[model samples]
Target: MPSSSATATVTTNVFEAGKYTTVLQKVESRTTCCPANTSPPPPVPPPKPLLIVMPCEAGEFPLLVFLHGYLLYNSFYSQLLQHIASHGFIVIAPQLYLVAGQDSSDENKSVTATTNWLSEGLHHLLPPHVKPNLSKLGLAGHSRGGKTAFASALEKAATTLKFSALIGVDPVDGMDKGKQTTPPVLTYVPHSFDLDMAVMVIGSGLGELKKNPLFPPCAPNGVNHKDFFKECKGPASYFVVKDYGHLDMLDDDTEGIRGKSYILSVQEWEVQGADEEIYRRSCGCIYESILGR
Candidate 1:
């Protein structure tokens, strides 16, 4: 069981180094050949934004929503999304805001991000079947987005949504005025079995989320993600990738971040870690936990 006093957070590869693929890259674009005098039509604003709906076999699918970390936009988290969607669950990663620089300390924006994600799902964009099964929904986020995931849960609980589970990817809790304490109050940590699901977290080298009071250790040297799983309440697992920084989890390649922190300098070419593998296994745990093997 996770200690009642505080929850654990891992932020290692949550923002480490790597070249994350873009969402636009996964989207199929239909190029229209225009006549020499023809002009492109004005872009139409969609009432409901498209949630990348990747499907697997004809079975009933569980909803998996992801919130990306700070500095990295939602579109850049495609590698992680594709990996999870491949495991048989439909996934949605909404681009809340694009965090591009250092010194991230915005709480209002964080709150808004959560609200937007909830709105995106509850909007008319979803299939009628997906709208009613709140019991089959799972919410996951990385870095600042992870904290936003918590906020999103609170919003949904107060409204017409009730998620099946919550997973934070090295989520950021530091900027929320110590709201990490809010989970034990609003969250009823799902059962180890019942489509009740689990909230297993994933981290890398420094396997813990920063800005979370529940996470007493931000970056534990040589932290073993497997060891943390023993303390986890889910019928799931925790993971710490070897030789990875925070951004590696995404597909973005880091050139200047190496100078920001010594830990961010590990080269993917020389490292032995698999960020995608860890992400796949973690999300897969969510998939299996929700739908059962």
Candidate 2:
């Protein structure tokens, strides 16, 4: 874990460099996440819920940690979450309750604690016959949640926990270095996040990307994927879907006639020209690299 004046520890990984094999194929025995061998320290994955839906065959599956945006609940992301879960990996989505008078510091602590507990608690939940070891694991979040995940990675307390990749669905804030602190070190990390697989899907909300106040303005023309992905740095790459509004990711909203769609609030959206396939591909890519099968 690399620590700076403000070290952001997104230490989500616990597995060391080892042979590629399935936990489901071997005797089931997973107890704790490996300790950090680096500076600062990794941020412990939060504990919320881990729902696993395996593929037909049993092998080591990848993990995609889902994080919803602010003022939102994990339940809201159910469609996307379940879609990812059905793809044969473990899905961990930590709920961050935003109540009145909640302090950001306290709330973040809760987030980190929950993430830690979840990472450590995985092996115990498996049935004797089912051992879940994610070959590749990562995080994907939207709106403020996306920003939180992106910024959170920069501050992971543990210097050793590296995610395969990070997906920011039209992230806002944090990316902009401010007077308070410099942009985090995630932009400079190696491919340690992913053992073998790596893919970063960056989405710009049609509503915001068109004329986003936080992200680059995407009005008349549109914001480019590079604008957002460039900030991530490292072996990280990106993807952006046009025409889709921010709320399209949610099943609740109806698509617009032209390039518009009923908003799912100021967050979450379906990518332009992308039906549900984007979700499937998102899971597919992450799944492919994590397991190394």
**Best of the candidates, TM-score:** 2
RMSD of 1: 11.9
- Compared with the true structure, what per-residue lDDT tens digits does model 1 show for residues 1-293? 10111111322232221122112212211133233685442142122222354432344456676776655555555555655544445566555544333233343344344334454434333344433234567777775566566555545534344676766665545423223332321122233222234656565554443433443343332222333233346455555554454555664432344324422432222245454555544544544454432
Please give the clash total of every predicted structure, in order. Answer: 24, 40
**Worst ten-residue run, lDDT, model 2?**
1-10
User: How would you encode candidate 2's per-residue C-alpha lDDT over 225-267 as one tens digit per residue?
Assistant: 3434554445556655555655456544333431132132233
Which lDDT value does model 1 have at 224?
A: 23
TM-score of 2: 0.57
What C-alpha lDDT values do all the predictions have?
0.45, 0.45
TM for every model, in the order presented, reads 0.52, 0.57
Which runs in model 1 stand beyond 4 Å of their true positions? 1-51, 56-59, 99-133, 154-156, 175-197, 207-237, 252-287, 290-293
Candidate 2 at residue 124, lDDT? 51
